[model samples]
Target chain A: MTGITLAVPSKGRLEELTREWFAANGLVITRPGGARSYLGAIEGLPEVTVRFFPASEIARELIRGNVDFGVTGRDLIHETSETGPQSVAIARPLGFGNADVVVAVPDAWIDVTRMHDLADVASDFRSRHGRWLRIATKYITITRQHFARFGIAEYRIVESLGATEAAPASGVADIIVDITTTGSTLTANALRVLEDGVLLQSEACLIVSRTAKFSARRRAQLDSVLSRLGAEVSL
Target chain B: MTNAAFRRTNLEALVEAQGATRATPPLLLPADPYFDLAGEEFGRRLLLTTATTGAEYCLRPDFTLPIVTDYIANGVGQPAAFSYLGPIFRQREDGPAEFDQAGIELLAQPDGDVALDQVFTFARAALDMFGVSPNIRLGGVGLFEALLAQADMPAPWRSRIRHRFGHPEALERLLKRLAVSHDTKPQKQPSRADLVTDITEQMVAAGLSLAEGRTPEEIADRYLEKQALNDAHVPAETLALLHEYLAISGPVLQSLTRIEALAASRRLMLGAPIRAIRRHLNGLGEARVTFDASFSPRLDYYTGIVFEMTGRTGDVLASGGQYDRLLERLGAQAPIAASGCSVWIDRLEAEFRQ
Candidate 1:
């Protein structure tokens, strides 16, 4: 009736990699309806049950302690405050997903190279324009914390649902903070990343919840699965 | 009356002559600043308020802000002292809801350091009256900043190091990377063999046995321990060289001599603040202190000196630091330097009574 509930990404290359990783460790994943089903089973590990969810939702679920373990990106984990005793990172560098969150402004502003320059410009803009400097990003918490450290008080955050890099060019915001793997899109939009504004360089990670309930037998089963997985990775 | 009454009479007379007194004020305070501005995380559940002007107020979470407001409202710019003792509310499942805190704030003082030293003496005397023997530990945030300057590290790495310095594990990792030359050719990714070898060497060095098989997590923990051991084990010859270059620790009067000598040896110019720190330490005998080249505290507000006092049980009884920039965020124009310690009253009472 009870088992360790594990959530993994539902679709895309990350989902494929998650299944392959477990299969490589001799734990085959099978679903009753195959491709159409969200539920799955880990072969030879009956004590483990698998649920399918997006990587972001998986992170949230793990933080809420609704799942014993999950696979998600490190960026999602850091963005949310519900971590630590509520949940913790078990392993990282799952070797599939990788990206960096960066702060970029208009490329024409060649004078800005660091966060300190942004701070200076923010103060000057408030003095001249009589309005707080605006930054557009989905990562409002990270952006707010980073600026708070530099004592930059006069700034407003504009939440972006998608395509944050286009905000600066489209007059939605004065600056943008978004995830980027390459400079191509930013350069195309005439936006350049500041040298010191990379907030996080994140990769995929396996997380475990500290508050998850486990019987002695279930814990032993989980340990066996983890040990086998660890060995397969090393090989 | 006997000798006890005579001593009590003399003490009361002295207290009256000095105009030293105390009072208790209402525990409840306006919730606006205490909850909203102070960022009280769980106030809604813990604080109860009477609806006085159709507005709710909570018990005061801290004394500094309320005292400052009182000072400004009364136009009391001249040097004045006040003490408060009462319960402050915050949500805690493990402790009492209403706890007592006693403190005195001295406002409008020209010499912040003099006021800081006076507070330390007052705290010591107060604890002595309760028959507590507490150990005093001294450190300064300036020391870590100076070390960063001495290392010539880049700004990004310096910020990262400073941010994580309070966590012992993270600090150890940073120090290991700093100890190695960054320009050296990157080593090949570590293999299981490398990890095993490191672990075996550490086990031998630490007198631990390798007879029992370890799980992956256990092995990983041992590996981390070995890495820390490798970092902390600086050679005597390297230490001598470092001492000659940094000249950081010595007798109080000779501290400057050592610093200057080390700076000259390293071809580095000691900054003005470094000299000021040496001057400050010279007055407080250096023999009573030890300068740890790697010590750093967690609090981000500390812009200068930071210290902690401990009791015989090795638990830190009091800790505080100078936060010259904290008042600026609270809307003060001129920088106000301050340092004060919060005595663990419950722990002190328990220990002294025992």
Candidate 2:
């Protein structure tokens, strides 16, 4: 309906950083209806309409082709893509909001150091404990893919909505697949990452939906935004 | 022949001749057993929904789990056989999410070979009536476990290798890792009995609630296991022999002979299981069957014989195996002697179309 629909984080430091990132690239984003408004526009690019959304919601919107482009974490892109990686393409990594999706166990369990060791623990977990090894994670799809790759199938996932690092100590899960920005929380929680357990190194990324209908004019409008941002990537 | 008519006459007759009673497991089942028993990859494909109670339920992904649950819950003390024919639901990338399948499960069957023969013969008979003679590939976990036991590694290494049986690539990776000797770091250690309390205190100090995590004892036991694993290395000669053994695949009897030769060369006794496999295959008396030493079903539960019947294009038409551990995992008080097979009518129809 519009020229190019671009979605960014609706609030907080991510929104501020996003605005600054755009401003530093010579494009000023203005909230047309003021600070509380979700609608916005670029200073000189009327062809681009800016909509603010919760970062996770932005990933879903991009996947559904409701937005031409969105800035969301790469973790969300992989987690939300039901089909596969081909459903969405990374236009650029913004380099902020950096974190890693990793598999971590309690530091006290020093014997486990790698995914191969984790597989051993998972296989013997049920017989030793009378239940499957419980992994706490919000990233179910990513975790499933990683575990399946290692041929580790004897674990169950306990969905963690908050404080995934605490899952092991909190008695809800035996291990965790979680996003960590710094190693502090894991250490404070007495957990250590497996030697080869980093499933994804993610940051804020400008992602384009391959499934989206990109008309010629819309493509041109997108090009204009990318050009002004000084971060042009073929969509 | 139409699949429905085939199911009504030939399929029903075949199952009836085996004395398998008709069974209808509920289409919607509690989701935990599937994820817990069948593993997450299989669980993820389930079309899942949540009830008001917040319990997750899924459309039956297959008849095996649900039928087994029913048998454990309501089965009489005597041995029993069950036949099921209906739609099973799963989210497929290439085809319909729901398809028709027919299968039988034999429970409390004291004889493994007898059970294997009955299920295989019945499944083959049903396929023959449909005029589809698919190539048969046979495998089993029992023989591999027997070999690993003879290999004489530590329990942790043996269990890990046994768990990774059937997945050749994973097994290869495990073997490579096993060949390397791990260096255990020098550190002051707590006694196993004290380690649980120490870890729990550490968690508490970190301001974590301990009610939901794995029991502290479980963590400590794993730590002890990790120390044990650190000190152990699978010997090179054993690894070489295993590599040779896993590569043994061909006509069933020939494969068995190769396995026997390998075991004898190492002066290791493989004992009854290898002979049992040989006798089992010889008893099959089926010309088309072959064996692959590394093959096992996708589901991790099969503990003994596993086989798949595939059409010319390699589309699996019927498959099943011995899941002796499955009943116990599903909460049986005692391990029940169990084995069975399932035939996919949809895949059979594909064969007919061809």
Candidate 3:
């Protein structure tokens, strides 16, 4: 019998939240070879094999159709996926992992408050510095799409693989588009989100790979999981 | 790279015959200086910051920038043609991130008839090496600007649309916003035209002018002109017609006819630019090319007649276009009539791989 595969974050708060959500929905997930193992299963549902990966990898796997279903943030999926007929169906939304991808700049740039102001600063900065302004973010696609919307072409995306909010202070970048749960981190760093700079308001989502080969048994497995999660109404 | 050049003898011969001198570019590129302006896709694919100095660098991504900078540095005032065989680094989803490329960049060239012929000659030679009569698609960033000029579109909307021209999705978003803006036109006291005339009279009476070079009358006239155009509103029907205009493609003559019909139906006087395009096509003579009203390159610099040659199997063998604005930004005293094409050597090799 062909079984459906599901991927979730293997570690951290996301892992805990995924487990708690599953348990609350009447599905207990556990590692067959103890807590350290990456391999897991839905306690009562043996046909749905659970594989654990890092949070970002789960998004990749879902998009690649390497996994039938996966749990990841909407920001990651939006940043990674193309704006077309998506290969991964954004099947369900989980109540946790809420964050907004916002465009943040240092608070001292008093002349800037909106995206148009940022565009002004960008061109002005280029004239003074002889180079386009750098905006740090791992959300390259989303950031690019957002900035392009405002006719802001005088900026660059620097891939911030670390603390993105600290980029302006470090002098590594002039601005940032980062996922923020609260305004505190940006505030603590003396940064302010632009008035029109919220690129995306993201949260945890259950993504299903539309490109996946869903056999009769696998489809049945997915239906069982969705129904358990109370997403049958949407389906 | 040399071996790839050796394999691409036909391309080299063509470049030499066209009178381009060979040039070399430095291997290490300063990423910070170039990354911000390389467009979204290029910015994403770059290899950044060397481990020690933390200074960002990338393998040379294209020859155009280096060629432009080199020309400026050398104080070459007159127009020149140059060719090079080199390696360009870009992240790829399906294949090697680094590959050999051979291309010729013709700078400060005459545009229209001359540019059309030069582009055709260069592109035809490259296609000949692949031994494939491929589909040709032509587009120009200028085409849109020409269309906008006919309709009294507001300055801000026109500039925004033109700025986002190469980006298809962004253009669509801007168009959608424009469509909605029609419903939100704020009511105003005194006709914008009458208000402008009032302001112009007031300013004349005060004997004061706007900052910079503009006179009070000129400034009032300009703003009122913009507001009057705004009052007219960019209608949904016009946007829909533009969508249909953008969708016009296939045969060169057929595409021209479609553009003419679109202009006629929409009441847009796209006569001059349309005729210029017609001239470019007719100038190309026997070169097999198709006009696609919708085509735009990912690179934002291109301002006219963009094109790509595909192999029989649908691989982009070479692509480039007129980038007059880029030359000025690259330190030219003023905009130059520049256009060039880059032939992907690896893609050419792959075309013959089977």
> Candidate 3 chain A — worst ten consecutive residues by lDDT sum?
A119-128
Each prediction's TM-score versus the true structure: 0.55, 0.90, 0.70
lDDT of 1 by residue, A1-235 (tens): 3678889888888889888877776878777666678888887677788888898888778777788787888778766642332356464456767888888876544345677556545644533454556788987656655665544444666779898877765566778888888878877776778997898887777677665665777666666666777721110
TM-score of chain A in every predicted structure: 0.89, 0.96, 0.93
Q: What does the lDDT read for residue B12 in candidate 2?
A: 65
Please list all clashing residue pairs in model 3, or write none if there are none: none
Better of 2 and 3 by TM-score: 2
lDDT score, candidate 3:
0.73
Between candidates 1 and 3, the one scoring higher on DockQ is 3
| Tens-place lDDT digits, model 2, residues B1-354 | 466575557776776677777888888999988888877878888889999999999998888888788788885357888888889998876434888888889988878779888888877887876777768888858888778887866766777777888778788998887778667664565798788788778666755555544556767888877766667667778889888888888888788788888878888777577766666665456547788988986555677788888877688888887888788878887778889999988788777767
lDDT of 1 by residue, B249-333 (tens): 4333355456556656756655564554554454443224444333335445456665555666666555554555445434556
For residues B160-242, could you state the per-residue lDDT of candidate 3 as single tens digits?
Answer: 55656666676776667567664545556455466556655543433323222223344344445444655667767767876
Who wins the lDDT comparison? Answer: 2
Predictions' DockQ, in order: 0.02, 0.52, 0.12
- Model 3 chain B weakest lDDT span, ten residues long: B206-215
Instruction: Give the alpha carbon lDDT tens digit for every residue of A1-235 in model 3.
Output: 4888999899889999998998998989887776579999998787889999988888778777788898899888778755412667777789899999999876544345777557545644555566667789998878876776776667767789889887766667777899899899888877789998898998988888877778777787798888788764222
DockQ, prediction 1: 0.02
Ranking by lDDT: 2, 3, 1
